[model samples]
Target chain A: MIQDRLRTRMGWLHAWSGFVFGLLLVCIFASGTIAVFDTELTRWLQPEVPPSATALTDEALEETLPTIRKLLERDEKPFITLPSERDPILRVQYHDGHEFLNIPFDPGTGQELAARATVGGTFFYDLHYSLRNGDTGIIFVTFSGLMLLIVLGSGIIIHLKELIPDLLVLRPFSARLRAWLDVHVLASVPFLPFAFMMAYTGTFLHTRSILPPVSYLASINAAITPVAVRAESPALQKEKTVVPALPPLSPLLHDAEKVVRAGQVGFILFLPKNILISRTDASGPARTREHVDFSYDGHFIRHVLLTTPLTRTQQVMEGIHYVRWGGAGMRWLYFISGLATTIMIGSGLVLFLMKRRRLSGGRVIFRLAEGLTVSVLVGFPLACSGFFWGNRLLSGGSEQRTQEEVTVFFLIWAASAVWGMGGCLMKWRVQVWRSELGLLAVLSALLGPLDLLTRSGGTVFHTPTVFAAVDLIALCVAAVAFQIARRLA
Target chain B: MIVLCSVLWIVSLSVQAVSEPRMLRIARREAVAPALTVRLMRWVSLVGLLLCLYQRPSTALFVWLGSFSIATVVVALGWAWRYRGVQRVRRTGGGS
Candidate 1:
């Protein structure tokens, strides 16, 4: 009787917790899953952006400094980041309230090109991290993550009976509870390490929010600052009154390489008064900290080494998060793990509503769950498809390109929500799922060919790396859609 | 020894699943049984030791140590609660 009571309590906790936060958790996971390959997606979407070759020794700051200085003379604090392997544009960013005025420069000629916004990549990034709602979103996500930790704990406790026995078992034809438990175990067990790390790191990420009162008491300035200040140093006054002619970038680059002992210099930043060269070692995988920042005024090296521990820690954290130090194999591992996390969260939500429907015999609750399932599972993909569609449809030189993209996203989402509600009214959960998946497959398959035909620069067949990846992912989506359609039928 | 451990595990699970009020008292007692606690502690320690051995003197060692420390704290809490419960029962002369 006591054991039965304990089981009841556990079941109650699981059901309530899952029902309340499942939908939001699914959104978070799906967005994050897509954002894992955000960079690749950006490249595939935008074909007009020109790729940069390695900056020649001859085309150093001596050649480029004048152009940069001339461009930045009017701005208060101008900065340039030299093109690296991932991004090949010499990006010049001028801070404007919460937004950046980005000017892409030709690495070879040092000529300023037309500015392009980073809305596509930035949107997905922000959605994953902040959910585009700022502090409220952060709080919601953090709370959901905490709840997830509890859910996992309770799940472990509840399934202690069959945990070991059911490790590899997937009873596809079992009752709803049994099937849900099987999926929960299957998804959770394989990526247990990832789940634990995500929880720990996620808590750490939201530490400021969790312990805000304490954090505020500890450091008031840190709590307020938009940009974190790493180091405190005496500002270098302009010693040379005259606008001194800058030294050639080749020598500076050579000197930086010697100091850092790196194979090749990635980027050379020409400040109005100083030149910064970012150099990384060839032996190790790409690390942010490995890229040494050197501030030089022509011949003199003002700052040789990083003076801030905070900056170093931040670099290491970025390195861990970005997995830049990990090669293709490690990246693939992270990708697979992220995919599993998405599946785990998505399936968990589905299971929650499924279980709830069994308990609550009301049509209202069932309809709500069905609508939410459709919105989250179908709406997210449709919104992403619309983002691509917006990119293609919007004129290249149009001022409202960003606005158009956002509009497309909202419109698709709203339409999906309506469609989901309508489907729920008709009790067409399986039919809606099948239909939406089919739509996704058709849209995904068309994306590559559309890009090839519409874009001037390159064809999908020619650039096998970018184009083939898109095609393959699309094909996978199509296959999944076909399977779902079949299952539904 | 393996048979004994498996029997203890099964007993703990059976205790956990009982729903009658009298059975619950027995179950709670079994849940915090010295034999069960010792077995759990040993398994946890073994896992920790193996991890520390595998990734000796590294971050993994620290992780094992941390988990062990947490388990120790949890066991202490469980013991304290059990002791309090027993004292309460003694005072009330097994009323509930």
Candidate 2:
């Protein structure tokens, strides 16, 4: 009797929790899945930037830093980022007034290249983490993660008996409820560990925001201010009295290489007397903070470890969330887990409508559920595809690219919502589902070729690993749309 | 035997909640006692769990002991409440 009661409680918890967060969870899952290959996506988005044929050498880095330093000193505080295998251009970021400037420098000569309107890869990085909405996005995503934990826990309780029996079950003929239940259980059970890890890490990522104010108070008292120090301003130094003789960069590059033992030196920045060299370790986890610093004129300084033990712990937590450290096998595992999460959210939403249909026994509730399902499942994907379309269609160097992308996203999402509502009036389930999926498939498939034509083949065929992966994903989505269309037809 | 029966009841209740519509119907039928008591019990349990998590117990031994003790008490209370409600409902319905 007690066991039965406990199970009942778990069922209630899971069903309601999953229903409430279903839409947000779907958004998180879809966005996060795409974000897994954020770097590749950026490369695909911007194919005009040619990949460097020659590796950036220490001598080249040394020669380039002095000029970069002089330019950076003239403007705002300049922090130079050395290029890696992933990105070929040396990037110098500085602030002029409220506006930020990201100037790419030729790695071989240290000469300033054309200033880009967008910091291409970093834009994707920012978008994935915070959606460029800052703290609001973090709070929203973290809350979604917490709700996911509740859903996972409750789902297990509700399906304990069928868990083992229905491990591989995917019944296509069953009623909507049964189908949804099968999908939810099937997707959730196989990737329970990965889901749990993501939830825990996601919660940890937003610990400061979710926890009581006392934690922040304790942080301040513990001598840990969250504010980071600004890099020395290039503009201030530029205005300062000229010192004709500047330090040579070769010695500094050599010293940094010795300290970091990186296979290649990507970029070097000299700020008056300080020389910063960035090294790349492709095999290990991505660490933007680990680099070698030196005094201008090649005097060995200390290796600047940007991340502390505490921060490293956070990085590892985020690494699990981002899945960057893992090899091809782990990447595939994460990909499957992410797909499962998407299915779980989608199924949970369907389950909500099924339960409502059973309760209401009226056409009104069914219509509402149908509209909601259309808006959430189909609408969100359409919005994302619009963003990619905008990237392709908008001319390069156009100041309105960001604005246009945002506009396309909002317009598509709004149209989906409106169409969903209208479909309810006509009771046209087949029409709604077919049209939405059809449009999505068309848009997604068009993206690859459009990218090829517009952006000089947009990395679709650049490297086999990336090209095959992206093309395969796009094809699978297209297949799903076709299947849905056939069913509707 | 009582504990085993209680466990079985909870398990059955959970499965019924998912698979059968009758359990929710029954829950709705019980106007006050079962519905209200279950909700109150849940809130109390949730609060206790939150407190335990927030404190961050220093030792593994301490955590194990505290968790076991809390679980025992919460389960006992929940089971007792449920048994009482069932008995009252049965008496009122005259063994329907």
Candidate 3:
């Protein structure tokens, strides 16, 4: 009897919280999954970056010097990222207060790439954690993740007895409610370990919001630094700024390569009198914060490879969550897993509403809740595909084209919400919204052809690329959405 | 080797899946999988996973874990196809 009571109580918490947060969690999981290939998406969004990276010659590195100095003169700190497998272009990047705006340069020709500026895949990455709202968004996502863990736990307790037996049992032709329940269980139970790992690591990455660092603490009895020393540092910084000419980078990069593992120096951070070249995150599980430093005049200063156990643990956590250490194969695994988890959350939301429909179907509250479901589930993906449409359709010469693309995304999403709410007010059928919006996304039907036609069509056949996979995936999605819309109708 | 380990994971899970009576029906057998076949496959795949971990700890560990995800979906789809002919699994009630 006590066990039954506990299960009932947990079920109550599970239904309400799962429905509430699962709506948003679906968006987060989908965006995070796509963010797994953000760099590739960024490349797809920018077609003019050239098909291959030329050798990282000193001449190519030197060409970026003038541009870097110009950025420095504007008091913006700039860095140069070396060509790597994922992205084969030398880039001059600087933080433009909102996002890292970059100028791509062909590694071989030292000429600037005419790639159009779009938020790119980083849009999804930012949306995943912060909903693109910055710190407050991060806090919201972090807690939503925590609530997801709770929902998972409660769900386990509710189904503990049948969990193992039903772990792999998915009966798609079962009763309507049962079929949805089976999908929820199938998506969740079998992938519980992954769900748990991602939720924990994802939240851990942003724990500072919950427990702010020492900077949050009052400065009671804090030691004050000498004002003169503080003033001296900026004076020294100004001196370095004045002496902007840099030493030849090719030789320095060569020496730095020997210090880093596999001789893969991914990025070069320029200093007034020094340069810090760091190891690539793609090389290993522990992004060990390893680097080699050199003086501006080509003298080796130090090579630092952090090996402390605590740091290693942190690095592994980041590597696991980020999935940057492994090759393309591991990334696909994360992407598939993330998709399944999103399906699980989306299925659970459907189940929650279905289970309650018999009891509260007539209430305004239920109607609004249904609208929210449509907004997130059908709306977000609609907006995602629309962003691609905007990328191709929006004129290339438009000013602030990045923001324009993002605005297109939100507009489509808002339109979905408007239709959903309108349906709520007019008592229009759910199937109408589902099939209409679902078909209208065309499930991103033209994405592949759009990619082929707009981007230089040569690259598609010549290279195995992220854009190709995205195109193929969108086609699959189109087929699936057609079937779903057909069935609903 | 990690690829082999991933394939082995699917094979092992398939072996266990056949242990269920519902799954056995797909193989034209009324009997469940032999206890030994299921146990042996499980042990073999697990030990291979451990050895992979020992050799290339980071990649091995990640691949080993990731295998479960893909394997689950693959096995589930297999189940779906086998059960495709059946409709209304439960006539009047929800799933257990």
Which candidate leads in DockQ?
3
What's the residue-level lDDT of A322 in candidate 3?
92
By DockQ, is 1 or 3 better? Answer: 3
Report residue A414 deviation for candidate 1 (angstroms): 2.6
TM-score of each prediction? 0.68, 0.68, 0.89
Off by over 4 Å in 1: A1-8, A50-106, A109-118, A171-181, A213-259, A263-318, A359-361, A425-431, A457-461, B1-96
lDDT of 2 by residue, A120-172 (tens): 33443454455555555666677778888888887787778876545444434
* Regions more than 4 Å wrong, model 3: A214-243, A271-274, A294-309, A440-443, A459-463, B1-3, B22-29, B32-39, B42-44, B47-51, B88-96
The candidate maximizing lDDT is 3
Give a tens-digit lDDT track for model 1, residues B1-96: 222223333343333323223333422444334456544443434444454456433233324433332232233234334455554564467835
How does each model score on lDDT?
A: 0.58, 0.60, 0.78
Docking class of 2: incorrect
- List DockQ for all candidates: 0.02, 0.02, 0.51
List iRMS (one decimal) for every candidate.
Answer: 16.0, 16.5, 2.1
lDDT per residue for candidate 2 within B1-96, as digits (tens), equals 222223433443333233333333333334233455443443333343344446532222222322332233233234334444544555477547
For A317-364, candidate 1 gives per-residue lDDT tens digits of 444445544444344445656666666776777777676666762587
Candidate achieving higher TM-score, 2 or 3: 3
- Model 2 RMSD in angstroms: 14.1
TM-score (chain B) of candidate 1: 0.39
Q: Could you give the fnat of all candidates in order?
A: 0.00, 0.00, 0.55
